[model samples]
Target: MHLNDLSSCSSFTRRSFLRSASAVLAVGPILTEAHFARAAALDAAVPEFSMKGIHLDANENPLGPSEAARKAIADIIPNGGRYAPPLYFDLMKLYAEQMGVPVDHVQVYDGSSAPLHFTVLSFTSPTRSFVCANPTYEAGQRAAEIAKAPIHAVSLAKDYSHDVRVMAKADPNAGLIYICNPNNPTGTITSKEDIDWLVANKPASAVILVDEAYIHLSDATSAIDHVKAGKDVVILRTFSKIYGMAGIRCGFAIGRPDLLKKLMDYGNSPMPITGMIAAQASLMDSDLVTARKKLIADTRNDAFAWLRANNYSFIPSQTNCFMIDVKRPGPQIRNLMAQDGVHIGRSWPIWPNYVRVTVGLPSEMQAFKTSFKKAMDTPAAAFNEMPPLRSRRDGVVV
Candidate 1:
């Protein structure tokens, strides 16, 4: 059915659903040209990106949700027909208590992407520009485009961390300054001291957006405390990465109650009952974070060792994904790997020759190693048939 059909669903209006759908297209999967090809291939009768491949493109946990979360989802299946607000309350309360914040300071969503987009729409406009690291996640930048908010993309520092001082001075009329800790693509981190400095030094009218999507995989301190201290900051958390709930879709936006209220100006929706229950179960599992962190780190470290042994250059990552300098166009390498039934992640426009690789199961990573070696071995002349790279006005892939 078309998106307009969503209007018939209770509580879903044409405008709200369209806004949400647009947000997904802007920030969700189908990012680069390669990703667009993969998306189209998925809808094709003879898919190019085979369903049976060792898929590690997205930064998703291959282990799936925790057992407790699985049981919680199963138990809540019967109540799927109900719009259970109580479950949302329970999950919110549990999350707030664990984070040591007031329940009112948290707002749950289907995924952090929605709030991420809405926050940009709420705060940014033609007069107030959006500021962010150049090679970081592009969802907010896309949203800023829709808002007609000018974008100021500061380049990453020499160590691949966000250049926070430069970002703070990017635009005096800045609406939002986005910092994705353990940043996407590179998987490197900006220190909390830099984040603190940015918070204190950013334009007076701007609010800082700190995305902690991969925080569980790293040893970084969260910016949630800034929220509790009533700073003009919003911290985004997702169960998609470490919790293995990407497909299930549960995330949170933590900020002062007033700051969160501004996000509601654009759109809001009821939390999915399954996501709520699973999130609560996941949060209550005390050992889940530590256990999964070590599992991912071990797998990632083994892959790094193999890369080192092979003399391949890669960014030392603290998250579940890392970027490797492929020594050729990233899309060409990605397509070659796809032909070999190994779907990997895409590259950013700023770094056309490097591709991101998500850490998967050990067996999957082994498959990745084999395919990567083969792709690398293939002659650069073999990629002559592939289309040349194209860039949008803002330097993002179209």
Candidate 2:
């Protein structure tokens, strides 16, 4: 009758047996891979966000996990009860092989955010500040706050790319320099040459952190090659972006084994086997990367075309999200759009009038254009209602 009472009962009845069997055959999968793309953890509080609102705020692949990944998840669901160390190591080996490095060079995480935080905790402090672009990914910056390290947020250059030279000059005693390639919100990129220069010019003691979370969406080469060349760079990669594993949570920290050890100092635990299996399946699908890249590019181009025709200003993007100037206060515009049942993203403090919009499906983006037009004209709409500050999914927060 009750959860506690069930534990006390020694008798086996049809109700109990069916309940037990149902838990395994149904609820077990629900508790894991069933809601892979849903932000179930965050929406528990703001239930409305989980509704039919068209969400273009976060940079998520509307084309969720690949067919291979779905199959792998289905195949692995029965084995969910076990934790196989060798299989986990096999994933590491697979990733390492792709990078053309020893398995020791790669370390996996639930997502790139964990290692990104642990890294700041690993190497930054009050004496050694964290240097990053003013509008870069905020996870590392938040981690720097917890570490009590000074934050030196250098503004983006004329091209809307990381001003690596200025960032290098921001704080000579910097412990970590974060570069989000195909930068978030803007989705612009810093050239490999500029990054190479930053690697060569930065203080010898400082470690450069390259976030390639969106690299696969762009034409850029990953900085993991720099790591292979024995540079003091820790490269972060995630299946969350292009691979559509935002809720599934699989990513990596690529560096020399010694550099990865620093992150491990904070904590290390076995990864969710579901995530690992899905990642392996995603990786093994040779065509997954190219096919998805084209889909995102096409969708992004269409959004840009609409923006140009509507006379709205926006930066050229290489990844799946882009910033658009709303002319009105961003939170005001975002809230009005939410009223239209289209949940958009928040603007950064630095650019109060600009909001980030992830490239969604063709139909969703079409809905966005209509709702966006109406929201822009609704002068009487309340402007003070901002979205939540945290979400279970990446790119949910500023």
Candidate 3:
């Protein structure tokens, strides 16, 4: 718990968010929607009809929840009147059993995003900076902003994996280091060994936050072993991806009890009964992870093959989403594709020409291919003029 050593960092005697913590906690939709609203100001050219069209923009599980999860949600609807705290404990126990960790180490949340944000705010401050890979997930960076923590964005390694060495040395006063495994957008994995090295070598006061949101979709090893070893590490897991419970919203933050306690300082609320019961039911279904993993991988590989044959340059990915270098302004292309009823993801400023595309069902992907080809074939002059890319100090696309 080196990062938990508060003496090493500046004390926040007068923080703005502390007074309005309740409002921040209550406005869950704002926190949740913040991830996808980057293009709202710039999306005037894209018709509203695009929302009703093929949605490959968000890395959502098109499969929705598993049958068991759906049944569990339906079964619990009647009991929603009561605050079922016991169900949260049940889910914690179940997850602990499955992951071979102590029950106290697992804290339930509506989704992984809460824990991610809490970890950033809890560990970082203006003096204790946040470090992360460039072009990785931006949610934690948002949290860092609220904390007024300086952010150090280190570039990825040549293979698209996180450059843990550079990240470890990014700041001597670093408080949090975030690593999104099978990273979002790129869908590439940072090796467990690299993460372990980072944990062992990072600034003594820096806590390593490993986001395993996409772990089930890839073969990358989990960082739970570090947490089990009592290292200053926190792991975030979400049922959003493989279990297809994105909308249902159940996730866990596993770490030493003390580390989790620090996160509770910001806000603590009752876990959604629907999310908890659905997660429990999902865990009970042993075949769910395996079935969905194979399904997503098969579909992803097929798309890769198509990209190769069509001479499209794209990053090799292991997760359910990947980035393709459309060789043009990504938003321009995204808008072009949306006009044809195929909506893809926005680009990171680090690589403006690349756009992320979620892996949908085979038919949806086929539609994506058709519309993607059409969008690419359309002359650049045909697309509407886009506003200059605006971003925060940390390079988060705004």
Predicted model with the maximum TM-score:
3
Candidates ranked, most accurate by lDDT first? 3, 1, 2
Kindly give the number of clashing pairs for every candidate: 0, 0, 0
- Candidate 2, residues 1-398, lDDT tens digits: the string is 32334443222221222332232211001111113123322332234445467878677777899989988988888988986554566677688899887766788888887788878877898999999997877767767877889999999999999999999898889999999998976999899999999999998789999999999999987887788899999999999988999888898888887787767656544577789989999999999999999988998899899889989999999998899998866766766666677777666768978887889999999999999988876655344344543436443333
How much lDDT does candidate 2 score?
Answer: 0.77
Question: Each model's TM-score?
Answer: 0.88, 0.85, 0.89
- Taken over the whole model, the C-alpha lDDT of each candidate is 0.81, 0.77, 0.81
Q: Tell me which of candidates 2 and 3 scores higher on lDDT.
A: 3
lDDT of 1 by residue, 71-116 (tens): 9999989989997655756677688889998777887888788788
Ranking according to TM-score, highest score first: 3, 1, 2
Per-residue CA lDDT of model 3 for 228-310, tens digit only, reads: 99999999999888988888798888999889878777675566789989999999999999999999999999999999999
Residue 266 lDDT in candidate 3: 65
Candidate 3 segments exceeding 4 Å error: 1-30, 37-44, 47-51, 384-396
**Model with the higher TM-score, candidate 2 or 3:** 3
